[model samples]
Target: MRKIIFLGALIGLIAFSCARLDSFLFNPYKTDEYKLDAYDGKLQFRLGPEFDIPQDKIHLFSISSQGYKIWGIYIGDTTTISSDTVILYCHGNTGHIDYYWQRAKLLAHVGGKLRYGVLIFDYRGYGKSEGEPSEEAIYEDTKAMMQWLKDKGLTGDRLVIYGYSMGTAPATYWSSHDGPLTPRWLILEAPFASAELMVQDGAYFVLPKQYVTDLEINNAEWIKNAKAPLLLFHGTEDKLLALDPHGKTVFDNHPGPKQAVFVEGATHSDVPVILGIEAYISEIYNFIKSH
Candidate 1:
């Protein structure tokens, strides 16, 4: 009887831990308007006036993702939506588009000032987007965005998929798999390799990823089949994802035309700022120009 009781208690403990792990992976805050100052306490520097985007150029809209309405922002001339090369940016798992608005603005200057259209959106269960969040939901949400782009006359050859941190999972997955559209280039910054690696990193043991979370995010493996030329950036001092286990692992596993830059002192959140905006833009511009 004691053995039976102990076994049941152990199972209960494992189940509870798994649920907690899953919840801890995603951190989102609700917002009706973009409060840039909300993240001020955590970030060392706020986006300056130089990064201000023109109100006329800023387009906000929503699309249906798995029957849930998700919001997206496009920074460019709508008149050129069909002809311009667009960068579909997948932001990190955190707050809504407001938290990443600055990053999207930076991408608008990638090739040149407003040379390319930049698109970013909030996934379901985040910000104003409705419904719950999950691994499959994110993938479908991202796919829905691609479909919207396709309907706008943007072809796979003119699309660039850029993913940072938690965003890398869907970016890598869609880039490799047969999806709504294929990207001409793949860019990853501060990418986590897989849920298994995440589990290994946090638990300090070789535990199965399923034991903690049902998330099957695996950029390291999915990247192997990606045909688009890859440009990857990893901060050497990234404490959140780390260099060796996460970013480097994904870079090493990729089997295609690839370029990697391990920024000297950049952290998980500030790769572009630490790498220098000019240099960051140059790297992406050159990559797109060459490929």
Candidate 2:
């Protein structure tokens, strides 16, 4: 009867983990509250007919992510993929690629010249991407993106990875794990140290420690082996993760050539504009050129 009892216990454990899987891995806010097609004059850019349709600027494409379709957009001219230095912009947890096109526009101006191209995408379960969200899932999806760039002849130093907020997971993951495919320059903005720390601080700080699942982003451990020149920026007044715990920890843990900027009085999403576009661009360009 011992074998039967053990089987029952194992089944119960699997059921519990399956039930909590989505809760642990993703915080997807699936709502039609935002439709990028109607880019109101009030907002800079939207993914809808009103915006991209007018200029038809965004080139939409698909990539295979674990047997499912995931979406990505090229924010500049079609030739820019071949001509310009590309930064694959991995955005934060909430919202889709439509919400981040404005960021693409800002990153296009590299050191006062339109030198950099931007590619932004929605992970599975975020925007139009297929399947559910998980740490490995996001990593493979982003790996497909790097392959796309290689196929387009953008290789080695020409490609850069930039991660914002929750997007830092895949950004750090690829840079640390992707061997030859890894780019030399990595730009991380408001990065979380790890999955558990992020959920602990943001979700349930008061509760005791628990290992609900193996959803480890592991940015701290990943950066130790990352040889690339890392440019990290964090806001002092961030409403989400505090600079002292999250960003600072990641910066400290990195054992490579790195530089960090602490923006005074700036909160999350304010790194670009708060420092003034020209100066911020200069900082980015200097990091890119020198590295």
TM-scores, all candidates, are 0.91, 0.81
Which residue runs does candidate 2 get wrong by more than 4 Å?
1-25, 29-37, 40-57, 80-83, 199-210
lDDT of 2 by residue, 31-133 (tens): 3333444433333222222222224556788888678788887766666566568888888876676577666656766654346767788777777787887
Query: What is the RMSD, in Å, between candidate 1 and the native fold over all Cα?
Result: 2.6
Q: For each candidate in the order shown, give its overall lDDT on alpha carbons.
A: 0.86, 0.74
> Candidate 1, 213: how far from true, in Å?
1.2
RMSD of every candidate to native, in Å, equals 2.6, 5.2
lDDT of 2 at 285: 85
**TM-score of model number 1:** 0.91
Instruction: Point out where model 1 deviates above 4 Å.
Output: 1-20, 35-44
Give Cα distance to truth, residue 211, candidate 2, Å: 3.1
lDDT of 1 by residue, 1-291 (tens): 999999999998987763546766677767676554344435434566676777888888899987798888888976787898999999888777878877887888887778899999888788778887777877888899999998898999999999989899889999999998999999999999999999999999999988768788999999999989999999999999998889888998888799998999999988888999889889999999999
Error of 1 at 70 (Å): 0.3
